[model samples]
Target: MRRLLRTTWANTVLLALVLSFVTTTAVFAKNLDVSLTELFPSDRQVKTTLVINKVLERFHYRRFQLTREFAAQTLDNYFEDLDINRLFFLERDVTRFISNAGQLHDQLQQGKVDIAFDIFRIYRMRVDSRIEYALALLDQPFNFSRDETYQFDRSKSAWPVNEQQLNDIWRKRVKNDFLTLRLAGKNDDEILKQLRKRYEGIMRRIHQFTVDDVYQTFVNAYIRTLEPHTAYMSPSTSENFDISMRLSLEGIGAVLGADNEYTVIQRTIPGGPARQSGQVRTGDSIVGVAQGLDGDMEDVVGWRLQDVVDKIRGPKGSVVRLQILPKAEGTASRRLREVTLVRKEIALEDQAAKSSIITIPTDAGAAQRIGVIEIPAFYRDFRAESEGNPDFRSTTRDVRQLVTQLKKQQVSGLVIDLRGNGGGSLTEATSLTGLFIRQGPVVQVKDAFGKIEVESDPDPDIIYDGPLAVIVDRNSASASEIFVGAIQDYGRGLIIGEPTFGKGTVQTLVDLNRYVPGDNTDLGRLRLTMAEFFRISGGSTQLKGVEPDIHFDLGIAGSDQGERSLENALPWSKISTASYTQHHSINNVQHLKARSAQRTAQESGFQMLMSRSRILSEIEAEDTVSLQEQIRRRESDQREQVLKEERHRFLRAQGIEPVDEDAESPDEEALEKQQKVIDKIQTRESAHILTDFIQMQWNTAYEQRTAK
Candidate 1:
């Protein structure tokens, strides 16, 4: 399953004081017919709030206090969560809310969430008004000749000072919407009809928001002030989370997150239907979903994220079709591409470790073969293992088999590719690290009470002692950081690629019902941060992450991405280093780094990768888009041309023919070929670097023998 972070279930019992809370409140019932305009905090929500505040304050790793200052921060986060673009609420509205921040701290202690509801009420009004205004604008024709620009990203912008200022912003936004459709070859009538439906759909969904939604949003805003990873899941959301963890749902295996009104694809799970389709990409928005091959496509624009997901999920072996708005086309583009997929159960075997070989030509007649193992996640079947299934699946067990097979192939070196791995089981991480080392500590865990526990390798065998390299990227996090950090600390392998995601903290899912025993009201769950991870070398991977010995310039700056970019993230710290023997395998790191740098500089493939990275970086840096039709079209074309030329170069370098830039999505075979070309560019270079190290070791041994 695709997850935001590594999580464990908390086994500790709730405090006696928390368990003593009176559960006399009427159980909140879900009623679709309830008026959203008069939303109020339920008695159950009040009780849940008190428990949440107590739990967070007493048990969270940060030990956060509900101070007046924190209350103000929560209010700010709540406002941003509701109106991120600064397009709805006025300056006076924000000021009015800010003035009451001082009193919010005390009110919250009494479980009075009236202020949250009050602000949301006004927010709903603003949303309704804005959508109404936008709908009206669709009837009017926009002048494409005007050289205007729309500031699409206004998260940091000041709120509109007055109604007139707000209207101007909305006017530009509506015009840009129209222009985007026009450029996509839609006629004026089509554009108008789509825009009207889209606007009305937005209003309709907002009106459908229930009391639970309001409470979840408000509580999470407060939770974020404590840490980014800690979150509150509503009862419904909790059920969905459970379904995901169990991997029981049959659907497109893609994680979805809301980006404003659009349901954006966060990632595709390995071995899932979405990944097998090869057409769905991260950042793409699902604008429409249909059941079966012949079902009518339902327009899902502006729908609730869960509702959209419900529309897409179905029984095993059933076919589902998705109308995707490609991320490369930007948000304004109306062009949609459809993909059909057969949903299937995402089994453990689907995500099993896979192995391959990369051959590098040496100066001598013989070529050097380097084995590459790609681990999508650190996974294990705990139930199967507990049941004494001798062949239970696990990352370490799978990799051990792969290593044995690779050795049979007589590969000179090995590479572990963990570029997009977001981590999994903690035990798997420790065991996986043990596969490369004899016996030593792998990682250190510090609990909320400052108790440090050293997680050591249980096995004493070194499975693969050959020249090794671990490739990581920004998405490599949690357990991934633990494994790579240990390898780097013990000098067992070379750490390559970008820095890992600096998520050193560990979270545990807490069942709220466990605290309030008498209440059968289904209070949902809390994912709370409870511990921090440190490398055996004493340095924490909290915010700094694990920096590679040989860095790959992938456009993203380390400081601007990963845990460092998150709000309220724990700072990097150090503990007493554990005693472990270093292999001294990477003694010639400087020489290896220089050689890799020199080779990559001259390599055409690396040059093209860097060029593509630069263009993407430039695009991400722009916060505004040109509203003028001619200028916008020219810019879009230029970007496409540059990217297309780079793709052609890459294809040629791989000895493959380049396809047309405007061509439809490629078939599964073509996608596999393209993926291979991408994999070679990164993995092949790492293989070459490892081969250099192997050759250097041979030369050093020869010189020493001669001297002796």
Candidate 2:
């Protein structure tokens, strides 16, 4: 299971669970009236913290001294982790904590974490007070005619200076919440009932927080200050991580994370029912969940991630419905929609490499058959292989067979589509590259001590050597970057589409129990970023990912997404280029780009996609929304209409009928059809580009022969 799991999502899922458990428990446990003294760090947590500090100080890839500055930064991060929007913590509270920032380093080293608990107690008190205030506000009728604005994204805003200022903010907040539900067509009574339940749920969640949760949160707050990728998981979180790696859980295969109070969809697993549904997407917030078709929807906006996961996961073949707030709508928008999906086990076969043939018509009335292979992830059944099984399922083995089949079909060119492939096994990445070029170095790994190890393609055999192209998007990362980097460095193929996700660092899970020897206590685990990957060509795909030879506008800006956007992310660096042979040179890359650009401009589908991207970008740029009912309604309707028109235009361009706005969820056949249409837009274009490259190569060879 460890060998098979290499994607960042695994670490992300673990960290998210840790955060979710710690962040929401206090809100839910208010009714229990837990004593504040019980929330202090335990002896076990103290020992674990000391061990974690030692491990990171000695082995973490990024090295830094535990100075006052570092302590201050960690303190700030802890505050942010607890109250991301600066809603609960007042200006006085922040000022009070600032005095302890300089002493945090010394206290942590001495296994003292009383300050973490102190701040948490104040935060819980603030939450309880705010919920009561909000409940009281629900009794008064809001005047929708007033022209006002609510700044929902308060991450950058200053904390409230006093109780009055805080009250005003909450007043606007509760008003915005009421207006959102009213806009969604709910009556005043329904809106008031829902708001009261939501506020009370917040209190209930906070009351559920335990001492362990507080300890985990503080440790992670310190760890995250060192690097975004590194995290400390609790025992329960470690158990869940193991379950995910084993693929034994039955659920909608979505990796979830906490974005403030909402449980946002990080990424859907390749073989999961969520991925197959065509409704779930990264960044969508699951606000409500219901079991079966007729079950009443239970609101889960502020619920713990573990609680939400428990609800979403069920026996295979059972139905689960999700009320999603699409990410593009912004937090202020209340355009909630529900999607129904059947639970299923995420099987290995569903995520394996698959092949297809795309026929492109030529100017000479002949059709060029282009072989397309989609690799969802780089996977390997290591346990099966170690047992001496002759045919172990791996990305390399499966892709090698697929290449052979494509060759037998006499494909004019080949396209390896790696869009949304978050990456997996590193061994599989190197082995897979071997099938393309002769034996050579694929990637380089550098440890904290600066020791470099080169991973190379051991096999001297080449599978398919014809005109080749690799398609990548923002999601292609880790092992995927390793493979694509090698392909580009060797000039083995033309890289197409968006820049790859910059995630070149390597993480290893370390069991804390191992350090204690015979101790029976489950000390949880630490996902330590101990190494960094460098391309064979010298550059590291850390913050700046591999640039494609031919680019496509996929509605995403490379800078604002992926590893580059993460705080405390490792910077891009370089090393000496490795020794390797260039298989082929693409001399006409500029001409190919021009050809692709022309075709893209003429395609209606591309135009529609670009338009939709602009609309989403506009929405993402706004930090405030109008609180005036009529103004807000006008803006919302206009935005919805534009988005609807774009969708209809895209559907018409593809010769598919657009579903109505209030249409029921599409069945499997309809979803498959929609997926095919979406796939055709990109894959078909890639096939055309590959065909163009093939012709260019043929023409160049003919010219060289004539000259000779």
The clash numbers for all candidates, in the given order, read: 0, 18
Best by TM-score: 2
Q: Which ten residues in a row have the lowest lDDT in candidate 1?
A: 13-22
Off by over 4 Å in 1: 1-37, 240-247, 294-304, 329-335, 659-665
**Model 1: per-residue Cα lDDT at residue 625:** 86
Q: For model 2, state the Cα shift of residue 653 in Å.
A: 3.2
Q: What is candidate 1's local distance difference test score?
A: 0.80
Instruction: State the TM-score for model 2.
Output: 0.94
- Candidate 2's C-alpha runs over 4 A off are 1-33, 239-247, 332-334, 518-521
Model 2: per-residue Cα lDDT over 1-708, one tens digit each: 223134433554334433332111121212355677788877888789878888988989999568888888888889998888888888989988877787777888886788888989999999999999999999898998998888887888898899899899999999998998888677899889888888998887787777877778888888888899888888866766665544444668777877767898877777777777777777788888999998988888767676776667666788889988877566555577788888776678988999999999876677899999999988888668889999989999999999999999899999999988877778888889999998999998888888888888888999988889999988889889999999999999989989988998878778999989988888899988888889999999888888998999756556778898788899899999999888877887888889888998888777766776776777767778888988877777777777677667878877888765344656655665665586667788889999988887778889999999
